[model samples]
Target: MAAIQPPKAQYQQVAALLRERIHDGTYTADQPLPSEPQLSAELGVSRQTINRAMNLLRSEGLVRVRRGFGTFIRGVPQVTRDAKKRYAARNQGTGAGDVEIKALGLTPRTEYVEIGRVPAPAAVATVLSIETGAPVLVRRRHLFANDEPTQLADSYIPWDIAEGTELLNRNVGRGGSYTRLAELGHGPVRFTEEVTVRTATDDEASLLELDGGQPVIDITHIAWDAADRPVEVALHVMPGNLWRLRYDWDDPTADEYPTVDGEV
Candidate 1:
């Protein structure tokens, strides 16, 4: 005899019904969902099955559970634009840091301004193609969204290019560093980014106010000029939960011309 199966997949069925109801506004945002036991009784399923279903929804960022109370329908998952999109945007306004938080209906602010020349890390020096321990101007900013710290960034630029300009000033002025660079005749024509996800360091965890074991997205930005000279190297650290990176590309390779890669 075949083992007994509960008609079909109970958890998925329950989750689908709940998702539809939520979509139709039968369960409103921030509104408490029915208790697992109540749902189990109503759906004619086991409490365990109901719980798994709720957990599935939670993983989708569509709902949150309040132990001993009940689950609640949450608003749409807040998402930050893909880093690539931000870099490619036309320079008509503020920086990506400013635009992102605002789009999410949160005000953006920068604080903890520590700007000066510092010895570049060996990895950074290699990417910048500068000698290790060479002095580079470092601008560190702690970015916040709605008063909550969300990103920590350290921008490294060649000392010659960054010195004697607003790049060293508290304000980058006008469009941003790109504008300044254009004025200096080394405006970026191409960009490259190395993206990674890693566990946060103790200090990073503290600064981002992250709970134990939360990961982070680390991005290394390298901007180059038309002649293939690297002009900027910036390191950005963003809290894992606060942002989602997206990339939409036409094709990996469809041309014989030199694309993003430095191949000819």
Candidate 2:
């Protein structure tokens, strides 16, 4: 027999109604929400249950409460990021920065970009299969939407491959670094990304313009050429509250069981 599902709780029903109102503009940024007693009467629930729902909203950063005043809208993110679409676009030669933002009706810009030679940190070196403290070309940039900093990325390339090339330029040409690398016969054929999240440091907090107590996602990407040589290692940091990472599941096209190598 199939298991029976429990009905929605009183607090959950109240919270859903309030969320709908907020999304539909019934409640807006800085607008005060109805009092618990009023909501209780409106929803036919107890004041205590309504208060619980209000607290849930507060925890979600949707509302704030003032000691003598009432609850007010705090605001929510309008930006969304789909990881698969982004990477696939890059693989197909369309560079980053404009596509997604334009779809959301926001302006996108590369607010800052720089390239320089630097000693590879131990972490980056390990992922790139290079010597720790070895010289590498660092390409750093801050991605912005509507003039608000949203993402930061630092890409490390082997000095041998970057020296005396356009990769040294502040801007990485029309199709981005990957396209430039392809011309140099070191184009990336495969990439692996590892992700983790943690609290932002002071520098990260300032650069990303993150609010207090906001966390950031750290994504490390290791790119390999056709010969399986590690060509690039990039570190991306995104403010957790402003960006949503999306992943889509699909059935495997190749053999189901594969070993450490790509072979099945």
Candidate 3:
């Protein structure tokens, strides 16, 4: 028999009960939790205690409060972003992270997509070797994993390269933009990425449904063509709590040593 433990504090007891429900699937990711008054009446706790418990869960990254919108449980981080595999899949004609998420049996989708010509921002111009304020084709979208918003992705390409191409379409179809670039004879032969972590801006927090003060992973990626010309620049911003990045590469020094015995 389990030991008879001392009673938990009112707020902690409330939290424990809610956490149990969350884990047991009584409260799923798609639905919001009961209102404070509802929970208070059901659990026979003071509204103050319920609020305190919710706040605790929010701080733990296990729940999110959407102001007017009710609170919702945040499930475990279910997406692993393996950089090498994503690029490799793209080369095989997969688009928009579909293959990666599908492999996990989760739905990957772009909830919002906008495409048009915009003057290049200074930073984007520098990366694409174009003049600031020059016309450039941009595609921006909000990506989702199942019903959960995952990331914001934006891609920029020089107007000369993007004009009249399907890259300007809201849906670039399978294999994504890279495959389209390849058809134009500018397929990316090399790529580079710069990654950083920082606090989310208000707009970012709203879009990704992140709690205030939550951090985000920002990635800047550039693709180069066979002529060594910069063909595309992309920015991907993701909620820091919901995803983990992965990188794998062969050891550089291994090539320097053929064998321990110095054989051919």
Candidate 4:
């Protein structure tokens, strides 16, 4: 067979078509996609064009590539802002008040490699409402989803509460730290989150599997205790292309809600 020329626009069109199929349930989540040769034949495009299209889909999080396995549709579903707000409300009274963390629908697996008392930095101390240089129990974590590093979180708990508790010695592989804090009587009653878009650092890029200088979403959150004292500060960095942030606000007095915020 003669070598087929690749068409860039055709490749993009193929990628868009595949994305639409995935969104509309034509290609179900976690199901293996047609092989490149098969897809090329079906779409009437060259295998090279199919390959490029698949790459685009993968980067856009519509598909996943396994080392020894074929490409599969990514199973994680996107949560809209309204859905997140509903989730947050539902989790308020439960022990799993960190439900927003779960609603992202990313499977979280944590490795607790270290737990020890360290002098709190000035910034951390200010957030925790403690004296600067106070002792705090630091928990270093590598958080993963589908076995891929999704977040690297460091949690700081005051030493007076955390060091003596089982939280120090236990390995909370999944739903560990947050659950333990709830058990330790410092469960978060309120949370404040701030989001910003910024370039990833070299270390962040390596750990989060992101391209250097690529834009990523930075979520800084402070979880507060029942008494409104800050219990933890968590920094989450997500691949900008793979995820989105959503928020919802309601004005109860208004008879009709206005969607004038340019959101949605």
Candidate 5:
């Protein structure tokens, strides 16, 4: 005999109905959704079912809940420009060079947990073109905005080049290492970057206040001077959902390109 499927409750049915209404624009962006008790009575469902449905919407970014302020329909996702050249143009004259947080459009507050010379790890040595165990200046910083962790940056600069500079002794508010590097005569005119995404580790989740299983974006950058010498190697981990990467390209006839539809 075939196994029987469980029967759906009236409350489940009602929750589905309400979800459809919201999706169909019955509840517009930033519009206040009906209270649980009100929706319960109107849809003839229990409050618990309505709550569950709302939770689903929240996870999807379709709704937002404000403590003591009720839930509201989320605004449409902002459109992001994808041209790398356009991105550079937009950032031009923004004083974004050298760890300027404003160029990233994020107000940065930094916790300078450590700043000193350390033997380069194998990975750092490879990136900086230094031998293993070579001393390098390591700067570990926790960057925050609006009291939330925005990024964790670990910068490695060869000690021979970086030592005795204001970059070593300055606090977070002074300027970014990139800017200081220029002042010390090793300015970078070119940068190469690699980006990846993965689920956050336990420690990362705790520090970033991210939910378990939430993915974060990692960006590794190697900056080189005009002489093609590597000057700085930095790693950054950022919240996936709160940030968007934009690139503007000049070629209008390029054949191959990339695209995204919802979560990857």
Candidate 6:
């Protein structure tokens, strides 16, 4: 005889039903979902059950809760960060973030958070091969897609490299920072990025418009010039549900393990 299956918990059932409704267009991106009380009444469940279901959806990033507004379905991610082409695109004058946003027919904007020389943070100093607390030019900005914030980017450059240059300005002009670095003979020819995922902090959740306890993607990027010296270090944070990271490269061991004729 076949084994019997256990019934789903009340919240799981509710969440599954709600998820189906969302997928079937009963809920949409342009409007908020019905209030919790209304959902409870319609589903003949307790308000607590409805609240639990909502929390599950929030964790999955299917919906977001606003302070004074009702929950709303989330749109698809607006950025695809491809490691292979990111540097190549930057060399052409725009960063991969802006290029991807524009490719999706969305507007991209950058709001400067800070632009000045300051003592480098401990981590940043280590990455830039500088003494702790050494002065460095820091450019911090918030990247937006349309009106929604997408990323917080903070870049650090050595004092000697950034001094007396437009890299210290609010607007670094057409090609952005990399072009300026090139002009200074420190153009980046290689890059390395370390990526991690973790729950968002209170400030990160607020800035990214994410529900509390939501996850986020953290990245630390280092750029090197032809001379093999680190030219810049940048830190990036983005909402986990609103970004996709892609990487592609040829296998380094391909030549060592060359395929023989009729190998199969």
Best by TM-score: 6
lDDT of 5 by residue, 210-229 (tens): 55566788877788987899
Clashes within 3 Å, all models in order = 0, 0, 0, 0, 9, 0
TM-score head-to-head 2 vs 4, winner:
2
**Residue-wise C-alpha lDDT for candidate 6, range 22-53, written one tens digit per residue:** 99998888889999999999999999999999
Q: Which pairs clash inside model 4?
A: none
- Give all TM-scores, in the order shown: 0.69, 0.70, 0.77, 0.59, 0.62, 0.88
User: Candidate 4's error at 72, in angstroms?
Assistant: 7.3
Lowest-sum lDDT 10-residue window in model 3: 91-100
lDDT of 2 by residue, 137-255 (tens): 99888988776676898989999999889999876777778888888999988877888999889899788765445678898888899999888988989876566666776768645
| Cα deviation of 79, candidate 3, in Å | 0.8
Across 152-260, the per-residue lDDT of candidate 3 in tens digits comes to 9888999999999888887786787888899999999888889999999999999998878888999998999999999999999988777767887789887777687
Candidate 6 minimal-lDDT segment of 10 residues: 255-264
Best by lDDT: 6
Q: Which residue pairs collide in model 1, if any?
A: none
Q: Is candidate 2 or candidate 5 better by lDDT?
A: 2
Q: Which candidate, 3 or 6, would have the higher TM-score against the true structure?
A: 6
The C-alpha lDDT values of all candidates are 0.78, 0.78, 0.85, 0.70, 0.69, 0.87
Q: Is candidate 1 or candidate 5 better by lDDT?
A: 1
Task: List pairs with backbone clashes in candidate 6.
Answer: none
Worst 10 residues of 1 by lDDT: 74-83
Please tell me which model should have the higher lDDT, number 1 or number 3: 3
Q: State how far residue 131 of model 6 sits from its true place (Å).
A: 0.8
Which scores better on lDDT, 1 or 6?
6
